[model samples]
Target: MTVRPAWLLPKGQTREDTRLAPVGTWAPDGEIRTRDGVVPGGQPFAATGVAAMQLQIGVGRAAVQGTTAQGAYPIAVDAPETLNFTDGNAQFARIDSVILRVYDGLFDESEQPLARVEIVEGEATATPTAPTLPPCSLRLWDVTVPAGASAGVGGIDWGSALADRRRYTTAVGGIIPTGWGLSFAGAYDGQYRDADGVLERWNATDATWETYRAPEPPVETITGGLSVASGWSLSSFDARRRAGVVQFLGMFARTGATLPANPNIGDTLVATLPAGWRPIVLLEALCSNGYGFGAAAVGGDGKITIRSWAGGNNVSGIEKDTNVRISAAFVQ
Candidate 1:
């Protein structure tokens, strides 16, 4: 028989200075964040545009249902299977770190303390690298679980594989007064370690992170390198105003600039400035996009600003009334 370990690699009791989960992930075809539902815990979470995991869709009993005996069951159950990286489309994610926290239900399963968690940092290759594996060739971590809780470190292996992307069902026969739940800090789900550590949408209509997750004791992260000259800009229609832009400047104080909402005089717009990436910024406006989603995330406050118009008058071909809302967390 295989011996089980005692300690399981649990969630970080003390939150780190830097957030791990990807922020504001965008779908390849469009600039919209995914609402694919909360991804379950203790598994490798990855996707291109949004932080949603595929659903465990069950099948209906077919003609076999009537043919099989009512009380009879298959001697061996064929579990659900995943075609590696099949759903992998535009968005790709590398784990900042995976956290697996222990849980003990609170007063009738009210609150589950993040007792223990496992953190993993690894890059996910293309969901499907062409002829190689279709879309996303995601190979989950083949973790060898220990038998005894007393044999290992919290039932987890250090310097070893833990879990995978396909599935996670109960392994050992354990029971509790109340069960537990978890939260995934996908791109939109920013604050990995705030009081609650769960994700709350800032502008649901616009698909942006909640303002609660900005410059503070709990800081968030935005990848650099999303500026214009790179190929585009984002603007709002008229409703989602409070829009703005965040730039990713290197080693510089993060910055931001908002576009005014005036569609009458000129076509309100926020152009992506061709600048360095890294330090990110946030923008708020009517929330517009190229595909007419009327919203997108491009640059942050850290980059240089290209006002809708240069020189008091509309530039050679610029419009002054373009409006874009911008935002960011500022340390006091």
Candidate 2:
């Protein structure tokens, strides 16, 4: 025969004649309190401390008017719902950490249930009856965080091998949509790919994107070699080439003889133009005596013509030795 231990009895039950039963059924002093729905003191059973509490919630049932079962009984039981705690005071309650144990259908050593322990500082609003906990403050589901990194530091790794950041290093060889642009760095600094897959750069001054030029072409310069035409001798000449345009500045002199004041000078080759290029005169001058007056124009043969007049008309009483300089640009 096996002998049962006294501690094996159910709660509020005791051993009498070596048998555990209800409180009043076993002992006269153990009486069930009727008032206040509270248990009476001096029950002889006391717990040291509660280590854990397990609750199995029952499902509500419906009523059926059919055959034998009169009252409704639970037909199907739902999985336990998540427990919620609230103070309903509109204040906040903080929790330093929480440990959650997860299991499959049955929990046992063979099942090896998982233990998820979170150690982040979190708070819940304390309104009135039920408190509400906010969602996680930080989300790092796919983040590759360092081992020793702090919990506060979490983000998607931009330079990670998992990311396709290298796509911007060079322009894609495939076709792209119109007006689509991409900005990159390194060898492509200030450069971008246009909709046509063509590389370009932002021109802040122009407020637009210009075709990117690798090793920009050097500016071209041409020496006119000094040409004197129509009694006009070349004094100095300067020419500069930039992109698709060229500009020239030429000074001419036909002095050593006194002439009428504000004399009108005709047709002069301020400068010659390159083939297929036309010259657009910017400034024409005839500096003689104390004042000068001249006008420049583009001739039919791409030559710059300068004509001088006094007060908009031919004048008399001029000085000796006059200087004429012409500034013009040639564009193809």
Candidate 3:
């Protein structure tokens, strides 16, 4: 049986053993198992245009997980590395990728456990696609080489050719970069990320990173056209909005000395909600008028109308000194 311990390299350890020692020492198990990309903070392997066929990669660091036996590896570019690309095809375009590669001698005798930056050339075709990355390689950028592109003849345009392929990762509970989600699927619910300065949480049920929004206090005092009818007076009123639904709560009392005759269906106007508080479609709700029950209709045009009433004398259903409760809700 082979016994190999990480973090501490014992005496007489070979170069290969030293290379694998830092695999688990640098990051936690969850991060090593689930994450592999450019490390956040400094400009990790940032590619900038240098010449028609050349790009300068800035100094940076990254982490990439190899096979189970090889484990994970930390790659660092201490100094900027300039790379050159082959001339583009005369008849068709191609997409080439700049990548950070980890070569393990255990997998291939000719290879050593060394991390290096290299370019993977793509095939020239009518519809050229980026080349498939080999195992233990992380793509940094995709350079689109147009037809007849060359350093001397019809120089390549670096501005339009370079497509950023750099995705970022960090410690297990750290905030990932903006485009990290596009390449990596969230492993569990409650995972958080930074999306272009916006804090977002991964919702497993929805399979998306929903923007985190602070809870807003409900509107205590109602506004807009809220005029009580001639024979009625308001006791209390308030409005609240939550999760795209607006709810109205209030109490109104009849002040007239005599009971009013039951008007036609949808006769009395109670209040008119503002533009944002109005519902997309007309909504109706059952309301209590102290002694009897009534139907309140909320229209799309922001009108609140008393539709009908039941109980009391057949002629006058609403009696004087009675209170009507306005308790309704609708989607805003």
Candidate 4:
């Protein structure tokens, strides 16, 4: 009696394209066993959808079986089931929609990217869960572990080789491009690195991180004076007008000083102009003693010159020891 080959039989035909579609059974020992033996599951794997979920490669293509051809393993997302290993260790179980857990080298829980991403399906859905990164530090580059940050709320390590700290250049041909290093710069708040790598803060007023300055204060009042002769009360004096290197000054005085009987045309007064100031213009002058108003001027030497005047000319005697007012504009 001769026996036919398994490929020639109906039961064997199903196993013929195991490369295209591998069929296996879940063992009570939590192992996925084929007619030959058990196969191990390779991970960092990705799958999606609700019930009858499949391990997808690109988007929604069914997985083809082969040593070379990529294939997605099929599994039910609603059920609590563990895909077992050949060593009899169950990888995991009770995995439902969007609740996939990741394991590290020691088989410890590393991350749950799927579970964290489920918030995107929340009642008031927000932005989709995704990765975020900043592009610069002491330098500009794609941020990553050991370079940009280790984990959440972590600081960037500038010493890491992955960060680019040098002045960014397009090619070795000395072609410099605008905004060559950093990316998505506006997405961040607070402090950031400028194009020159200088740490700077955002100026809300100008909407830039460039140079900014506060406004200057308003112009102020400036006052100065000199001592009056003995018995002369220099009550109040003010300079209200401006000229070329000069200030217009007005003064009120109670006088007691002696005066020349017949004052000369260029008679100097007791009061002196401040340094760097000279009386160039005289507007008015008045005396309480009814003395004639005198013509006043400031010389370039800052000397107050009270010239004998035609009217109110009491310089001989009536002007002596009398109340007087003087007004003159000075120039520096």
Candidate 5:
């Protein structure tokens, strides 16, 4: 299929394309699939105002240089059942109306497109499978196993190619891309390998193997302007703002407001500019205890600017604006 590198929606809002479509907005016809009987009596799904969920790729961030480590992500929001009800007094919890907001990005080595997504469902694990994969990226039945039959959760082996880990022992509720909140990335895992990979959750005795597939996107070829097509490569970033973990994927072009202080000696560019495309919530993430850090923003248009603090402290010590040529799509 023809995959492009762009988010359908702006930050803090649902993508226009998803305004009246399924939560998995990027999924065309089929991209991934979930195991039958996996969700049990799949109660029809739907969504309306999804504006408070989180998104994240499920791959290890740790990797060698030259490529991103393999990872996984959910194109849907899997959550627990609410307003509980059932068939004829048999009140088994049921969940419905899970929505996911997705953003598209560059392709990886396997020609797979990276998708940043969010789910607002209660609780579910997003393996690299579908009812989630975009239409052009799936052929699910080709690897189907028996329904209701426990694979790794009970007794399934995912071969020896993947690292053996613990798996889940139950068929918990699954979500299909519901929610629109803060998220870390697109695609499932960061690693878009060119071959089969595996994921396992602790299942008491041993790690249960998950049934999934992968469509690795090619992350080669560094660019000049660092657009989505060029891959926004920032100069330096603040890991202090990192919520949990911090890893530098790539350097970015400088796009900050000129400062008045003399940063000639040792002024490392901490945060990155929205120069490539546009930044929604760009902030300097530090490696500290997630506190004592600072943040500021240029408008979505990115015309507003701020100079770095002399000592990297955003306190009310002293700040100065710059007289320089800046570019932004939106005005401050």
Candidate 6:
């Protein structure tokens, strides 16, 4: 039964047969499951305060991967598992870890695929540090035992003494838990993950994770301050801005009781383009005076001035009754 199927167990199959591959299939291998950690969801292996020096771990499931020879092992805690810590060192504090461990007889000379929850006591020193996890084990929590602490006399404070070491994994392509990215390298470019509350994508070239932001609309319409110069009134006009470019389309007609026989080449048409709508350098556009062609210039000061006018017969001035049409675009 070296190459056994993971599912559809036959009637005569033994316990060892299930451990061969059924458990691994139930929890597939991938970036998420192949890593040693709790199978996230529903308070898996939650540790709670119990009597002094005692902690109770709620039922949970986890995956543990050992050497290639030992392969992977899955653990399930159907009932609560209570762990008792050794009496605190009389002179200094110590850190102890609750771990889910797999012991394979083929590799450990013990029961084949034996899984259990156990405590690995830490060394007591002036600055106590947690014990190192052995191979084929997943740490669930770290408990700090202060000096002189005992079950009944000066018991441990569950809140301050317990440090959660549980990490989580999900099905492939699923949103992994926060902090997962900090420990594992991204699988590919454009790989996405939830970083705390923000969505981020991996950048393979830069070897970094960048925040994802939605694209914004590019063009905006200019709504106000398109006033015409004295003796001129707007007929139809539109002004829009995109990036650093500003565009305009409009018709201006002469007004007032007295009108010049012809508009001067230096006469102003638009008084100002308003702040932020001005150009960095002077820009010119060819215009029409209904009867002849001319040119207009927009200065950095926001004024639009008539630069030239080829009135009928190649004249330099525009007829007073002729309407002016200006269509232009410039970059600020």
1-332 in candidate 6: lDDT tens per residue? 32222222325555654554326422234344365566667787888888887899987766677776555665667678888888988999999999888776667766454577899999988999999988788888989999989986967889899888887655546555663235555555766667778888777799788887767649878645776788777777778887668898777775743333345565556556778888898888768866677778888888877766666655445545457788789877
Which residue pairs does candidate 3 place in steric collision?
none
Clash count in backbone of candidate 1: 91
Question: How many clashing pairs per prediction, in order?
Answer: 91, 15, 0, 8, 71, 0
Please identify model 6 stretches exceeding 4 Å from their true place: 1-33, 179-181, 214-332
lDDT of 3 by residue, 1-332 (tens): 02222222224555554453324323333433646677766676778888888988887667776665566666656678888999999999999999988776666564444666889999999999999999878898999999988999856788788888887776666777765346445756777778889998778898877898878855544543466667778787787777787888768786865445455344577666666777899889666765667788878887777777775544366667778787788776
Better of 5 and 6 by TM-score: 6
Candidate 1, 218: how far from true, in Å? Answer: 29
Per-residue C-alpha lDDT of model 2 across residues 1-332, encoded as one tens digit per residue: 11111222234322341342122211110132110011112311111111111112222111111112111111111222222212211244332221111222232233532222122323443321111212211110111222222323332122440111101111223212232124322222253434356666655566566777788667877656543555556777777777667677666675545334335545545455454445443433333323555566655455666565453223453333566556666564
Worst-scoring 10-residue span by lDDT in model 2? 161-170
- Which residue pairs clash in candidate 6? none
Question: Tens digit of lDDT per residue, candidate 5, span 77-166?
Answer: 233212211111122211112221223343243343343222222212223222343321211111112122232233212131112111
* Candidates sorted by TM-score, best first: 6, 3, 2, 4, 5, 1
Model 1: lowest-lDDT 10 consecutive positions: 59-68
Rank by lDDT, highest first.
3, 6, 2, 4, 1, 5
Q: Hey, what RMSD does candidate 5 come out at?
A: 24.6
Candidate 1 matches the true fold with a TM-score of: 0.16
Residue 188's lDDT within candidate 1 is 27
Scored by CA lDDT, what does every candidate get?
Answer: 0.25, 0.34, 0.71, 0.32, 0.24, 0.71
Give candidate 2 misplaced runs (Cα > 4 Å).
1-192, 195-216, 256-290, 311-320
The residue-by-residue lDDT of candidate 1 on 87-161, one tens digit each, is 221245232222222232321142543222222333344431111211111222332222222222232232342
RMSD for each model, in Å, please?
A: 24.6, 28.9, 10.3, 25.6, 24.6, 11.3
Clashes counted in candidate 2 amount to 15
